[model samples]
Target: MRNDFSNYFNNSSENKWYNSSYIGVSLSIPVFDGLQKRSKSRQAKLEYTRTGLILDNTKERFNVDFKNAINNYYNNKTNVERQNQNINLAEKVYVETALKYREGLASMSDLLQDEMGLSNAQASYLNALYNFKEAEINIMSLNGEIKYLINK
Candidate 1:
């Protein structure tokens, strides 16, 4: 009676066939063929190794960019400081030259030169400030710090 019941279930239309006959054979053949298995394993290892190297390169590149941005910011800051110093000196020179010209002791050309120097210094200082801000932004981007600042 048990055998009849088992046969009935095995032959029933509702019974789902897994078709696992080829599954074991397919799995065992790769192991039996040592060359194929070794080749596949080597390929997978190589792919993983390559992925690690790529990630390392990306990390190193970001580090380099961050360092460069830092250096740029410092350099721009130095430039701005120098420009400020120049503007201070130019102001004194411009004031003295203007007084001298009013007393007819200095030429108009000299006063004009002093004014131009002051203007140039002011422009350069503003440019340096802009550059410093941009460098800071770049560093933030490289460090992945700007993500929080994004609206999305």
Candidate 2:
């Protein structure tokens, strides 16, 4: 609601006030915008769902990588232990072969074969150790950058 009032003057050497008054009233009722609101609501819901799916996918991927890192770490640890055992057994065999060769009960070829076996076992053990270290690094990396940094 609104109103206004004013005075008019007649230019006849005399000023006079005339009856001039205005009054107004207004009311607004809105109509729908061709389902624009509904469309925006649907878009918002779809965007929320898409965001949720993306979050779930990222979590699943991280889980898979973490599991793989742990598996590799355990497998490498086993390999290193096995290789160490092999080296120990190879050293014993080599020492026995050397003693036998000195007593003339074993030939030079037997001693040489035992020496080569010992060397191969040592190399395999080193390789296994290296693999174990790599797996450990992978696991630490998966845990977080902070852990890897701390270790470094």
lDDT, candidates in the order shown: 0.87, 0.91
Candidate 1 lDDT by residue in tens digits, 82-127: 8889889888999999999999999999999998988988888888
**Positional deviation of residue 128's Cα in model 2 after best superposition, in angstroms:** 1.0
For candidate 1, give the lDDT of residue 18: 73
lDDT of 2 by residue, 1-152 (tens): 12222222333446655799999999886686889899999999999999999999999999999999899999999999999999999999999999999999999999999999999999999999999999988887877875758888
Candidate 2 stretches with Cα past 4 Å from truth are 1-32, 146-152
Q: For model 1, how many clashes? A: 0
TM-score of model 1 (CA atoms)? 0.72
Best prediction by TM-score: 1
Among all windows of ten consecutive residues in candidate 2, which has the lowest summed lDDT?
1-10
